[model samples]
Target: MQIKDFMIDQSLKELTEHRTVVLPIACYETTINENIHGYIPLHWHDELQFVLVRKGEASFQINEDKITVREGEGLFINSGCLHMAKDKNNNSGCVYICLNVSPSFVLSQELYTTFVNPYIQATNISYLHLVSKEFWANNILDSIMKVNQLIIENQPYFEIDISIHLTLIWKNLIMNGVQLEHEQKEMLKNKRMKQMLNWLHTHYAEKILLDDIARAGGLSRSECCRYFKRILKKTPLNYLTDYRIQKSLLLLQQPESNVTDVAYQVGFNSTSYFIDKFRKSMNMTPLVYKKYKNSHSPFVNNST
Candidate 1:
């Protein structure tokens, strides 16, 4: 089945509105392409996400670190962590199942209170992205596959079973996932920095200054620079540039769009400068990237 493609805002809204009411879930086996070589672009939400790679390999970036997981391996993402997944191998491909669950649905007092509280409390400590080796019995990957099967089959009380298994999975995660005590303290400061990012995302077309972002994050100019570098490994301005590059990619996907139009829409004031940066980050000119995407996609139509 085709998974629904959602914009960032719509995905966030779905996560919030369905927090405790309905379990937000999806499963798909996707064909990977060789030309698409990079992370899926950083994004985040409130729901917990489980990605199980049944076949092939991919690199997953969680927060600041990158982890590689192969077939029979899986990654668990905690709520609100910025992450991206990509297939790095150009010749081979992978198929995976993605599952998203609202934390509140699993943590509610009505069901599995004993197991849920610890998992919820752990979220406050650090984000998790565990890669395990075993794909068979007593392994997180196996459990995730079982849950996916149950979800697809719509078995009786399957949601309950999935929730229960997820609780156990979280328990294992707490045991195995890395402890980030020092990182957690730094992340507290970084959380404020995210406000600047939000503003940039909302107002990319307008001029943004270092002082402006510092004020938004309630930090001194020097402190803001340090904080962003410490967490994201990039300065605020550099992050903004990367964000613009990503936004330009979405615009380029439209067959009618030209490189100049996409550049301006994504906040670049100079078309030549936009082209330069796009080429640097994407390794192709905007038009070239657009043509490559169109040629690779089977669904694209040449005729309007």
Candidate 2:
């Protein structure tokens, strides 16, 4: 549940620069089990991202759509899309390679205007699942894997090689054509949802009410409930409680922290209520979970 070194502004825009000014691309091999929560929390950035499942299947929530990418398959997420990923099968956590490339890294102005800008700004195309059944999609998957490998190995001229692969992937996307009618309502819902989630993340440690959340999103209580149900499949208060519990996990692992103190710090008015919710969500009491995390080598891979 902890995003290592991950920072987001009040707008819920991720502050991490996955791609640099000089390189404009970066890749990483991520394992779902390594993340304490077995999922990457919802966040977005300006980079167009490609995720290729290397070992297991991953279920992704992009905006309000759920897409599952299996082994050897991939997914393309457009820039500025709200997305998160988790293991589809919890028994074996998903292992995937991610490539984040700047949308503006085009070869020329012509390419940028013709292929990149429109695709990145396409409100209807939040994400596209890539399966091996489609030949072009398979190629894109191969390119994504190759780019990850090239970056990992740091081979000579790997930057050039990676760029070539990315260009090919971009061409495949444009030539194949992904088109859908825009849904302005859904887009606005996504914006309002982000606003509310941002407020929750910022104020989870403070006492909150349903009306407060609604006001933060500039919506009525009913509309706020509907939005949360539509996007997160949970009530506003439920999501807030879940978030508080997630925040408490890291605190619970701290050496000086105790269950009662941690409970109050995370905005739980009653320690018993916190313990009950913790037990239900984690299958253990907060004290037991704390002791276990303390006894074992802590889960240090924080980049959820």
* Model 1: per-residue Cα lDDT over 146-258, one tens digit each: 87777678777887887787766666665664443334555565467557667667877677888887888788999888877865778988978887887787689887899
- TM-score against truth, every candidate: 0.78, 0.90
Which pairs clash inside model 2? Answer: none
lDDT of 1: 0.67
Which is the leading candidate under TM-score?
Answer: 2
TM-score quality measure for candidate 1: 0.78
Return the lDDT, model 2, position 287: 97
- All models: lDDT? 0.67, 0.82
* Model 1 spans > 4 angstroms off: 1-5, 10-22, 29-38, 107-114, 121-138, 155-157, 174-187, 294-304
